[model samples]
Target: MDNAPLVIDVAGINKRFGDKHVVKDLALQVREGEIFGFLGPNGSGKTTSIRMLCGLLTPDSGRGTCLGLDVLTESAAIKRQVGYMTQRFSLWDDLTIAENLDFVARMFGMKDRSTVVDKALDDLGLSGRRKQLAGTLSGGWKQRLSLAACLLHHPKLLLLDEPTAGVDPKARRDFWEEIHHLSAAGITVLVSTHYMDEAERCHRLAYIAYGTLMASGTAVEVVTGQHLHTWEITGTGLQGMGEALRALPGVDLVASFGATLHVSGKDRDALEATLKSRLRDTPLKMTAVPPSLEDAFIYLMQGSQDQFQG
Candidate 1:
């Protein structure tokens, strides 16, 4: 072991698929035992970059190490030490949960497959559903099973691509709880997600768009750096009001939360001045509010160009 605090330290990574440049000059350092997130819009190269980090896929150009192993030369070594879960369910749905776990253990060729499978099931709280057909399980249960399957090989790093997508709110919370527990146990995690709430749960976050890096920092730092202002508008016709604000200059994001409208823009003076002018003459009421993570993300993305060509 290198005794280094970082599990992934890479620089100037790039990837291309024929005419398409999927990732561009990306560099990142992920600390051991921290929940670091890679957040971006769809087709933003998050997946490609993550694959390069864990040695799952080769980068056309890059120099780095994962778990003190060369990302390019020691790819097979790194692959054995990482747990990867994809955006879609890839487990055997026709088999029981216990059978699925046992299969994964067998694939890894563990010396004690039964012990590992039993421990995995018990650790993930899947003992109750061990005999259930995976195809009949709900999204949450399926997520748990997927996680258990990944952990069967005793990986040091966990790479999750939107693991909580389509899961219910309560299940998402439970999933996060398990993630935190794993982090506490000295496992490094690199996750990709779009949910602001989930991003907040991460120790640090990196934002990417159009195959380029944007802002990366703690939640508060990133939010503050965006320099966005918000206005909370509450009244009837809020749905139409959102549409009206969309075309207005200086408005980066106009979203509704139940009965209220959140309008955000990077330009503080222009945003306040513009919304003041818009609401001054109309009957609509507006109140200046603090900018949030979602507001900052929207502002950052608004500045991105569609360079992905997808």
Candidate 2:
């Protein structure tokens, strides 16, 4: 991964609307053929940042290159080489799957529109439903059709904005499989998602909150970088344990996971001491466990100050 050239490299990018600062000095570098995951809470500017990178919206300030073209000057050229799938399904719902693909091909001005459309249908497993109305299809099928349209231009870079928001688990898995396949074929992908499992699938990940970048690295690195200590507590009647733990000093997070409670804190010794002292008379079992990506994700979100709150 270190040997690959950067497909998307930008720094100090900022954007604003009226008095609201949307994205503030955001910087990122996505490697060639890499699946870089972009994660954040809702209203965190993930979508806006994506637009700036893909030439759909220009950054208010900052300078960098995308696909080695000047982001500030050659946005049109960048847009041509990049395929973007929006968070919402933006395709024509009244049109059939095949017709949608044909329309996208026409927009790209491909001379061999028929051949390109046919190949796209087959590639994304949409051929069987080529005549199906996009609006009439289910969420998974619509997702497949959106992906097919994105690839019709044969773009070198793919910017997917939560492509699986409402998709089923099976369809999400299939979409990710296709993503990995595309990466192997040397198509760089920059995707935004809220799912931790999907974030772990990427070669690297970046977490943003309130339009600010808080962390970026491999899954392990991001988890370890937080230096958080976590303990799993299991026992009967664990209902009120979370509230009790949250009130204690040194306990930063207390989340319930099915049959167990994951308690985490930044101060290791203090957290351990508090847990032992509080639970010594109880029947609960406390076990030291490694901090997970989700733990780190929540931790980051908790620490971030919402820009709109003021």
Query: Highest lDDT, which number?
Result: 2
TM-scores of the candidates are 0.91, 0.97
**Tens-place lDDT digits, model 2, residues 35-133:** 999999999999999999999898999999999998988999998899999999999999998999999999888989999998988877778889988
lDDT of 1 at 291: 77
**Model 1 worst lDDT run, 10 consecutive residues:** 301-310
lDDT of 2: 0.93
Q: Taking the tens digit of each residue's C-alpha lDDT, what string does model 1 give over 232-299?
A: 99877666888888888888788778898899887778888878888776667898888788878877
**Inter-residue clash pairs, candidate 2:** none
After best superposition, candidate 1 residue 170: deviation in angstroms? Answer: 1.5
